[model samples]
Target: MPRAPNEKAETAKQMYLEGQKMVDIAAALDIPEGTIRSWKNRYKWNATLQKDNRNVAKKCGAPVGNKNAAGGPPGNKKAEKFGFFSKYLPPETKEIFDAVQDADPIDLLWHQIQIQYAAIVRAQRIMYVEDQEDSTKVTSMESAGSEAYMVQMAWDKQASFLQAQSRAMKTLQGLFKQYDELLKSDLATEEQKARIDRLRAEIAKVEAENKERAGGEQPGDDGFLEALNGSAVEDWADED
Candidate 1:
């Protein structure tokens, strides 16, 4: 009497098997191309997509590699040999590491990190000073005492740069610790560890110089932060 729904689906499947594109099959059966593709995907019929029958090898019993393709060993020896480290760090990560090989990766990364940290400290100080400066301008000072208070506040902010230098020192120390841990573990290679050690020494020297400068000066206005935040913030706030 009536054909089964499964029977209709099977017939559609057979049409797909018999050299029919998804679009052609969908048009013929009044079904969507997505439905046809779904059917093909469910059945794992990969051959229907190929233009030539030569490329359509057996799905279950296929050779590992083609004999025609060149060289002694087909797969990459370097990738296969590197075990867990290679599995986590694929070719793409290795390529990035390779690109920065000439310069010390640890040193470069630490410098970048320190630069970012210094920028942040400088920014915070700038914001604080601008807020104080704006307050001085906005408030009506009837006395020299009020004027002196505003001046002191500005001076305090300039001096706070010395305090911020300590923060920079702490940041470098933390990074050094992290770099040391990373190097000591199996995560990085010997070359990476050596570079990290070299970078650590350079960073330590920089921090020491900054410490000496901060210690030698007065606490608030005349320190390292003032020098950095000087005309830059003035220009930034002026622009805004």
Candidate 2:
């Protein structure tokens, strides 16, 4: 049998339709803001709200042949663009488009930075190797009564982790470069620039400490693996 819908979710949907912000709805209903956001995304609340608005506008639309109410208000093409997208795109994609339509480029890049940084930090714990003896064995294939297992030795796993970390750090560095370029533009706020600068300083400090530990010599490939194993990376992870 199909499960019943959540009562709070229904109430939240009604509040959303009535033009309440998600945070406000969460506060009023004593729900977590994350839950409210999840419900909004899962239920296509923005699309529903837009559909309702269109319905109301259709009902109260200007009289036929009235030249005064023409061309969708001055310089406003959002309705037409949104209509096109709504007709052609899936609800989830449309929601993402609407969400990021007016977002600042620098802010968008910062969000990517946060996501990439968090992923890199998370990989450390997932791919950690205690010593040379530590290894992982997984069943690679199974058919009928026969099975094939793949054993990843400690050094092999560590090498794989290092390579993956290298690629991730390269992507992260590229993001930082893009962010720096964006910050050079007038559109970026002082706060946005400062945050990137601070993060860069923190990363550089960690890298320097790692180099110092390795006989004060700068290693090639940006010392990413060295920084990855350092304790300071955990502190950086906490910032996210």
Candidate 3:
């Protein structure tokens, strides 16, 4: 016996999923676009597409701190690009990067730690802290005045820098822990995704209403940052 009339709907779904546009799928399947659209609406194709995109992004190594890694499985164009671009990466960085080829959440957290540590280095460089060393040698009290001041200044600078670095590391470690927990989270089910979508729609509707009431003005990213700060997101996150 034939499988069922609903099998055609399944076939239509597969064609739509495999990169076929609605019109093209409808034409090829000899079905009206409206009928295909109805099948798509019934089956929630958008969520399916989002999941597929996430899988593709993972396979493509989509900019998750490992874009410059050398080599990959053969015949994949993304792998070929990764192979070509990775050689240009700095040798010192490559040595550390190549030592571990895993993309697990723990590996990602390790990379985040390195990046946060380098941020401290960059902050030091921006402040020209490298030239802060003192070589003044003072022995006699008469000659000690200027040299003592220089030595004390140098000591204070070093002490301040060390304190800043210590505080930054502690803050960054906590943030990375939160991110690692997020990364280790299991994928959301369709029901959860739908609920999230509905909540987002509600928020967007309120935003639109507010924008309209305020002479069509909307807040840019700066405003969002100010709001976040006012909301204490940064304070709660341990940011200074």
Q: What lDDT tens digits, residue by residue, belong to model 2 across residues 1-240?
A: 999999999988987785566666665565787998999899898998898788877876667887864555787854444345645666577668778988998999999988998998787678878778998999999999999999999989877876777677667767877988998897789999898767767767766786778776443323454443343344333323
Provide the clash count, candidate 1.
3
Candidate 3 Cα misplacement greater than 4 A, ranges? 1-83, 110-149, 153-163, 166-170, 187-240
In candidate 1, which residue ranges exceed 4 Å CA deviation? Answer: 1-114, 117-152, 159-169, 203-240
Rank candidates by lDDT, best first: 2, 3, 1
Q: All predictions: root-mean-square deviation over Cα?
A: 17.0, 12.4, 24.3
lDDT of 1 at 133: 56
lDDT of each: 0.53, 0.73, 0.54
Q: How many backbone clashes does candidate 2 have?
A: 0
Better of 1 and 3 by lDDT: 3
lDDT of 1 by residue, 80-136 (tens): 323333334555775565567577556576666567556755655564554445333
Per-residue alpha-carbon lDDT of candidate 3 for residues 113-229, written as tens digits (9 for 90 to 100): 557646754755543333446334444444635533324455565556555655665656575446545554574344433432353365456556767776664422112222212
Q: Pick the candidate with the highest TM-score.
A: 2
For candidate 3, give the lDDT.
Answer: 0.54
TM-score of each: 0.29, 0.54, 0.27
Give candidate 2's TM-score.
0.54
